[model samples]
Target: MVNIANYNDLVVGDRVIEAGNSENFQTGDWRSLIPVIDIDKCIDCFTCWIYCPDDCIIIKDDMIVGIKATHCKGCGICAKACPKKAITMTPEE
Candidate 1:
């Protein structure tokens, strides 16, 4: 059987004790909402990418492509930063 740590066994704070180990943790599973990008409405201004805390915005050749759902925590910062309203937060189903 797999061993899982309960709340009492977890660390006290949200600190990264080791450097260059953030990739080992995947935080997307707990998000209640997800960001959706409308490529048609995107102006390629990179506004969403600038404000995204998780770096979930995907850019290609100077164009906003999509969101990286695997690492996105649905903070809604990207949606609010989109000047063209190209990004929207939707409930995760």
Candidate 2:
């Protein structure tokens, strides 16, 4: 009989995450969502920028807000921070 533990991908050194390599993650699992902003209703109060834990919301000149998805963890803070309901949390396609 073959050992069950023998057939796994384990790569040590330089490639490990600082959060550490987790041994139990399946494919297609979601860790976050991306926040989308509606420019029409946004007043650019900078609430989202201040509230974002990842500092991903970039507001420019009180006119537009940009969501940096690469740096964003999508904790929905921007949605909550928006006083005008201008932000929504949507999953990446």
Candidate 3:
């Protein structure tokens, strides 16, 4: 349904063009793995939030709810930084 023939036509020299805004993009599909949060084991220390490169960890009422999978790249930084081992990286289904 989409056309790729025009892709070459859109290219500019060297520099890459800034496409549409990232908010409209769902990059989670690019990940082969996903982070899973066990809120029960979470100590509410905010460590995960501090280490999450994508800042996809959801926080509310001073508590971490979960991750926003849409922007998460499954880099595992949050999981590694969690002292409570509350976050785990799992294969995406």
Candidate 4:
């Protein structure tokens, strides 16, 4: 799918990009889960920041919050490091 949840614009203008040679768009192919931040529960622990294997976690003002969902391999390290039980592992729908 073309990320229907986020971007709904399907308009395609003329471009030099070619089709058919691109990777599979099949549903059976497995994909990784990307994290979204819940700022309410974030306590600036920075534990999730240090534990991220891919260094995907985003930090501001010393707070450990969201991970780079696109790059995240769905590793549970961020969820484990969240001392406040803020991070939750969710399947990509």
Using lDDT as the measure, the top candidate is 3
Q: Please write out the lDDT profile of model 2 over residues 2-81, one tens digit for every residue.
A: 65543246446435555633423332233367788998888877888888876667766665658765566667877987
Point out where model 3 deviates above 4 Å.
Answer: 1-20
Evaluate residue 18 in candidate 1 and report its C-alpha lDDT on the 0 to 100 scale.
69
lDDT leaderboard ranking: 3, 1, 2, 4
Instruction: Give the backbone clash total of model 3.
Output: 0
TM-scores, all candidates, are: 0.77, 0.62, 0.74, 0.56
Worst ten-residue run, lDDT, model 2? 21-30
Tell me the number of clashing residue pairs for each predicted model. Answer: 0, 0, 0, 2
Query: What would the per-residue lDDT of candidate 4 be over residues 1-93, giving only the tens digit for each residue?
Result: 553433334335634365763223332223365455577888776777878876678776666545665456676778777788777777677
Model 1 spans > 4 angstroms off: 1-18
Residue lDDT tens for model 1, 1-93: 887778685567955566877666788886999989888998899988889888888888888888888788888999898889888889977
Local lDDT at 4 for model 2: 55
Can you tell me which runs of candidate 2 are displaced by over 4 Å? 1-31
8-76: candidate 3 lDDT, tens digit per residue: 666566554776557676777777778899989998999989888777999999999988988898888
Predictions: Cα RMSD each: 4.3, 6.8, 3.6, 10.0
Question: lDDT per model, in order?
Answer: 0.84, 0.70, 0.85, 0.63
Question: Which model is ahead, 1 or 4, in terms of lDDT?
Answer: 1
